[model samples]
Target: MARALNDGPGRECPPALPFVLAVGVTGHRKDALPADSLLTLHDRLATVLKALTEQAAAVQEANQSFFSDAPPRLLFVSPLADGADQIAAEIALRLGFELHAVLPFDRGRYRADMSDEDGRVRFDALLSRATCVLELSGESDHHLESYVMAGRATVAHCDLLIAVWDGLPPRGRGGTGEVVRLAHDRATPTIHVPVAASDELKIRWSAFDPAVVTHAEDQANVRTFGEEELGAVLTAVLSPPPDEREREFIHMFQGECRRKLRTRIEYPLLLAATGVARLRRHHWRPEIGAVRTHEEWQTYCDACHKVAAVTTPIASLQSWYEWADTLASDYAQSYRSGHVFNFVLAAFAVLLALTTLVLPDAKKILAVAEFAAILAILLNTQIGVRRQWHRRWLDYRQLAERLRPMRSLKLLGLAAPDPPGTAANPTFGRWVDWYAAVVWRGMGCPSGAIDGDRLKAMASTIAEHELAPQVAYNKSVANQAERLDHRLEIVGLTLFTTALLGCVVLLLGFAFAPHWVKANSNWFTLLSAGLPAIGTAIFGIRVQGDYVGSAVRSEQTARVLEQIADRLTRNSSNLSRAGDLVEEAARAMHADLDEWRLLNQQHDLSVG
Candidate 1:
C-alpha cells in the first residue's frame, strides 16, 4: 500500500520531536534605560541572538545523530513590553529564529502597559509574527499575580533565560530580577547581557551559578564568560548528554515480542508521538499538512507542535507487550520465592515429626528448629504482603491484556476505547487507557474513507498474519494449562492417599498389636497428626497456585478466541463482513481477558 499522501491545507502529520531551544527574556524597560543606551542595547541584543542561533544550529547537528527525524528550531519566548522584550523579539526574528509571545492578560488590557506609542505598534507587529501566543486567564484585579505567573510560565517553558539587566534588584512585581530569580530556582541557565544607562558600549556577558546556595549568593558570584565559553555553554545547556533516568524510562517500554509492521518501528516512530506526561498527541506521518494555516501558523512559530503529538500506535502496542512480559517475569519470581519458603517450612514440619517418632536419640530441643522455620514462614508472608508483589503481578497482567487489542485496532486504523478515569479505574489500567487515548487522538483517523480495497488489504493482513497465529497460540496455552492442572491434581491426590494409608496402618496396629502400639505410642501419635498436616499443606499449595482455576479460564479463552478467529478467516474475502468480524474478534478477546482477570480476582493468596 502507498503510505505517502499529498500534503495540503489540512492537518499535516507532525514531524518527530524537534530539537527546540526555548529562550526567555527579562530585562530593563525603555524607561529604565538612558536615551543614548537604547540603540546600543538593541544592537547588543542582536549580536547575542545571532551567536545563540549559530550555537543552536551546531547543537542540532549533533542531536541529529540520535534524534534523526527531529530538526533544530530556535525560539525566543517573551511578553513584548516596551524595551527588552520587543528588542529581543525583533532581533530573534531578524536572525530567522521563531518568536513566541506570552501575555498575562488579553492584548487589549496588556496594550496599556506600553507607554511608547511606537512601542505599541512594534508590540502588535511582533505579537502577530509570534509562532504561538499563550494568554493566561485569571482575575485581572490581581495584576501582580498575573505578572508573576506569566514570568513563571515563561521560565517554566524556556531552556535558557536571557536577562538584559545590570544585576540590580527588581523594582516591582514580576520585574527582571524576579523572573531571573525564578529561573535560578529551576536551575535554568541564564545569559546575563549587562546593559547600563550609559552611552559607552562595553558589552559583557555572564551566567548564573547553578551551585550558588542562595539568590544573594548567586547575584554576588556571577561567572563572567568570554567568547570562548559561549559555544560550550550552549552545548551544555541545549544538547547535554542524555540522562540515565530517561534511558531507564525508554528501556521499560521496549521488549522482544511478536509485533505488527507498525509496532516493529515503535521506538523510532516515537518521534511521531508527542505529549506532556498523561496528555499527548500523535502525528501518524511526517508528510501531512501543518496543524495551523499560514496566518494561524504565525502564532505558533516558536511552538514545537510535535511535542504534544500522540504516541505512535505501534509504540503504545509495544508498551502493553513490555508490561505483560514484565508482569509475567515478576509473577514467576514471586511465586518461586513463595514456593521455596513453603517447601522449607514443610520440611521443617516433617523433621519435627521424625524427631518425635523415628529419632529417639535426639532430644526435644531439636524441635526448636521447627519453631524457627515456622517463624520464618510468617516473616516471609509479611514481607510479600508489604511488597504487594502478588497484587502488582495481577494488576500489571490485567493492564497488559487491556492494552493487547488496542495495538491491533490502532494498526488497522479503527476506533479505540475511551480513556479510563483515574479515579474509577485501577491505577495501571487508567494509565494504559490514557496512553491509548493520547495515541488515538494524535493519530486522528486516516484522511479518506476506508474503501473496499483498504478493507480487503486489512482483512487479508489480519487473517493470514493475525487470526491464524492467535488461534494457534491460544490452543497451545490451553493445552499447557490443562497439563499443568492435571499435574497439580496428581500431586494433591498422592499426598491425601499417603495420609490415608498411614491412618489404616495406625488403626491396624491399635487393633492387632495393642502391646506394640502402647510401647510406641509417641510414634503412632506423630504419624496420625503429621500425616494430616502434611497432606493439608500440600493441598493448600495447590490451591494457592490456582492451577485448576487457571486451566479452566485458559481453556475458555482459547475456545472463544478460536471461534472468533474462524469468523475472521471465513469472512476475509468479504470486506464489510471481514471488518466487522475483525472488530468482533478483537472485542471478544478483550472481553475474554477481562473475564479471566475477574476469575483470578476470585482466588486470593489462600493457605486454607
Candidate 2:
C-alpha cells in the first residue's frame, strides 16, 4: 500500500521566534517631574544605569555566540533609546550583528527636542549602524504603534528578540515595554535584565516554541489536530483496493520497498551540500501505494494513537510528539539555566579567590571566608553541570555505545553498559534508530544528513526526566572528585616544596641573623615551627587528594557517558531509513534472519 503525507496526520514543526533587542538609552531625560526629588531621580538613574551596562555586555556576548557559535542564528537587533541602546550598538559594531530601529517619532524632531549634548551623539551613533530604521509616525494611537509593531512582526519571523527593560513598571521613557510586549506576542524569549538587578542577570533562551516564549503567540503557532481531520487524511493508504489494477500498483510499491532494502540504504540524510531547507526545494516522492483509503489511514492513525494512550500511560503517538516538543522546550531552558549558573558561579569563584588574596594572612583566612565562598559556588556549579550532562549528553552516549555495531566496540574489548535505570528501553539504540528512520523516510533525507553528528544532536532530545536527579548526583560526585584531584596535585607539589623550603629557611635564618644571635639563636625553635607547618601542609594535601579521587571516578564515568551518547546519535541517524528498508526487504525475500544479522554484523561500518 502506498501512503502520502496527505494520507496521514502531518507532523508540525514550531515557528521561529524573532531576535529583538530593546536597548534602553541612558543619560538624563529633559522632562523630570517637579514632584520628583533629586535623591529619588538619582537612585532610579543609578539603578537604570547599572542595568544598562550589564544588559549591553550580555547582548554583545549573545550576539557573538548565537550567530557564530550556535544554531537558530541571529543577525538583526531591535533597539530603543537609552544607554542600553548605546551598549547594544557598541556590541553590534564589534560582532557585526545587524541592527534595525523602530523609532517612536521623527528622528530629526526627536533630536531637536533632546537637550543633553551626549544624548544626541548616542542616538546618532545608533542610527548610523541600523540596517533599516523605521519610524512610528502614525496617528497618536495604538495603530501608530503598529508601524514599529509591524516592523517587529516582520523581524519576529526570523527567530529571537532581545528586550532590555528597566525591570521596573512600564512608566519610563522610550518603548522598552512595547518591545517586550510585542516579542511576547510573537512567543519569543525576552532576555530581561532589570535596570536595578545589575548584580544578577537571568537569560531565558529557548530554541523555539510558545511555552518558552509566551501564551498568545504559542496559541497562534501550534495547531491542534482532531481525529476526524486525521482520519480523512489516513483514508488514502491501506491493503484492500478498488480494482485488480490498483492491487497491481500495490504489488509494484511493495516490490519497490523490497528492491530498496536489498540495495543501498538511502534516505535519512539531510545534505547541506544542497543547502539548508533544501527539502522544500525538492520534488515530492511518489505516494505510498495501498488499498486503504485516506479516511481509513486516518482512522488507523487515530486508533493507533488512542491505543498507544492505553498501552503507555502517557498514551498515544500524538501525545508522545507533544511530549517531545515540551521536552525540547524544557530542555532548552534547563540547559541554558545550567550553563548560565555555572558561568556565574565560576566567575564568583574567581572573584572570591581574588578578594581573599587582599585580606591579611589570607591563607589563614581562606580556611574561613574562602571555604564558604568556594564551597557554595563549587557546589552549585557541580550540581548545574551534572544536570546538563544527564539531561542529554549521557543518554545519547549510552545509546551510542549500545547501538554501535558490535565489532567496533569489540576491537577495543569495550562493551556497552546497560545504564542502571534504563531497563524499560533495553534496546535504546534500536529504538532511536527506528525513530530516526521514520523521520528520514518522511523528510526525504538524501544522505550524510543522517550521520554520526546528526544522531548525537537528535539523541540530545531523548534525555529522560528521571535522568535529571541522577545526573545531578553524578555531577556532585564529579565535582568533588575533580576538586580533590586538582587539590591533590597542587597541594602535593606545594607541600613537598614547602617542606624543602622550610629546611632552606632554617639554614637561612642562621645566616641572616648575626653570629651572636645564631649562637644564642632560637634555631631549634624556628626549625620546630617551620617543620610542623610543612608537615601540616603535606598532610592536608594528601588527605584532600585521597578523598577527591572518588569524585574523579565519577567524572571519568561522565566522560564515558558523553562518548557513548555521541556514538549513539551517529549510529541512529545513519540507520534510520536505510536500516528499516533493509529489514523490510529481507523480510519480504524470506532471507535467513541469522545470516542477515551476521552479514550486517560482520562488516565494520565504522571504517566508512
Local distance difference test, each candidate: 0.55, 0.35
Tens digit of per-residue lDDT, candidate 1, span 1-608: 00121122342222222356777887777887678778788877877787778777877676553222435666777878788888888988887767767676667777877787898999889978876665543236767766775676566556667888777777678788788776665555677777763423222122333232445234343555445466766665544234544323222322222211221122122112211112122122211212222222233222212222112234434434454544444454464356545654775566585666667666566677777777777776677566555655555565555555554454333223422322121111233333333333333222212333444555555555555656676766666555544654565567567767877877898899989878887776676666556656555555555656666666666677667667765654443354346556666666666676676554443233
Off by over 4 Å in 1: 1-313, 336-340, 343-347, 350-354, 360-365, 418-432, 439-454, 573-576, 602-608
Best by lDDT: 1
TM accuracy, model 1: 0.45
RMSD of each: 18.6, 30.9
Error of 2 at 568 (Å): 52
TM-score of 2: 0.25
**Model 2 clashing-pair count:** 50
Alpha-carbon runs more than 4 Å astray in model 2? 1-76, 113-115, 136-158, 168-174, 197-199, 204-608
Q: Against the hidden true structure, what lDDT does model 2 obtain?
A: 0.35
If scored against the real structure, what TM-score would every candidate get?
Answer: 0.45, 0.25
